[model samples]
Target: MTQHPMPDGRRPANQGPRAAARNRAALVAAARAIYAEHGLDAPLSAIARRAGVGQGVLYRHFPDRAAVATAVLEENVRQIEQAAAAPDADLASVLGVLTWHLTESAAFIGFLHADGEYRRSGALARGLALAERVKGALRGHLPAGHRLATADDLMLAVSMVSGAASGLTRAERERRVLAAWRLLGVEVGPLRPFDG
Candidate 1:
């Protein structure tokens, strides 16, 4: 079948540099939700449908699956960076943000170890930097005498939450997060969705 761009010779909402950027952002956002719900293995076409864009548009913005996933990971890193930079941010605050991310981006983290175009991208580097920011905030609002004495402690706490959260629902992930915090003696009220 012969396809046409449009009667006006330009497609709807997918023309120009501004639309390209918007389409790229939409694709990335759609990829995040699709990946979180369906795992990182979800088809690229799924992301296109979720973004309300055609496969051609998705491919134009992201040359491959790794490119789209890398964009999502980059978005995550930026969000964490913003959360960590808040003036009143503390250990609990940082941990809360990480907790929210654990459920949403666990597969994205695995991309750090995967060999692909994503490896060449700087997304993994930003993710590692976010770790340092998290480690730095561990002492800000921890319980007295129950503080994490070293970076390993932070790793242990994060691992517990992330490990337990694998393949679980949002509420289940929240429960696991709370248990992990208590295991480390850092009583954060409850794991809630992080807006930052």
Candidate 2:
């Protein structure tokens, strides 16, 4: 078999910078899958294996499992923030974005709260910033001079709606979310079923 050289010229199949980034992204995605499967105790070696990279490459990309977890969380939050900031994003758009994001964010939040290591790493900071941006987008939808004063309030309302959806089935989640959006004054008639 032909030998693959590492970009650093030290290891075989040494991928270049772009390939390294792709590998790192694959590693992070693998980490997310492993965490979802094993509840955050998933092995780093397994992550490397899943990413098809050597242990040394995984280490070079992420110092440890904690780093991998943090990277995954940060990437998730960054995606949410970007979605929130997309052009022509109105109240309905923002609500849909956040609602979808929160559905997935619960997993990361569960992992973060359970692990002390992640708490000190500022992993949650990026999530908070994203949450604030989402809240601002929601607030912008409020009627002029309406009383949605703080991000906390918006977050709480979202949490309530999301949590309420948990008790019901998929169709119920959709129904309740639409009702909640209307209650929040979002004029979600066109966006009902939140199909958008």
Candidate 3:
């Protein structure tokens, strides 16, 4: 197999799969933060720089910026799903769980909007699937027959919460999210004023 050239004009060390995977994870995390701060338009070269690795390292891990975005989205989805799996919850409890996930998933939220050339929906579907799981969780908590009825509503609320997170300031974002939860009858924690 032909070895790819490193960005620094050197060859990569003969690292095995485990090391490569670790580096890829680091690069994905760095890319997520950069993308969140700078939006999708952030430069791949900058992502490489922030990762403390070379451009070639990023390219090796993510063939392009979209790939990095997708990986970030997938991570977000994984996290939300894991949170939704917290056992024993009512409708309010379920919404609170989702609220926490959305708060933590701010960076990956961008993937939910990538319907263009970036095409990161595969990664997004994982997160969307979590919403579906949350719907299921909510069903068990609600009164009989009310659980499934809220599926569409919950999904819509998740979408709105995600949208609110993007345009509003961090403080405004939290307020919007809290309001959304309260509207759904979820006993959300009090939100701090916007500091950022």
> What's every prediction's RMSD, in angstroms?
4.3, 6.0, 6.6
Off by over 4 Å in 2: 1-14, 120-151, 158-196
TM-scores for all candidates?
Answer: 0.73, 0.63, 0.66
Which window of 10 residues has the lowest lDDT sum in candidate 1? 187-196
Q: What do the candidate models score in CA lDDT, each in turn? A: 0.69, 0.61, 0.61
Candidate 1 vs candidate 3: the lDDT winner is 1
lDDT of 2 by residue, 60-125 (tens): 988766688768766665554555466765655656655553443334545534546666766567
lDDT score, residue 31, model 3?
A: 76
lDDT of 1 at 50: 91
Which runs of model 3 end up more than 4 angstroms from their true locations?
A: 1-15, 87-115, 120-151, 167-169, 188-196
User: What lDDT tens digits, residue by residue, belong to model 3 across residues 76-133?
Assistant: 5454444445564345545555555455446556665567655543645654665566
Residues 44-146, model 1: lDDT tens digits: 9999999988999888788887778767866765665666677876666766766777766656647656665666776578657756655555545555555
What is the model-wide C-alpha lDDT for candidate 3?
0.61
What is the model-wide C-alpha lDDT for candidate 1?
A: 0.69
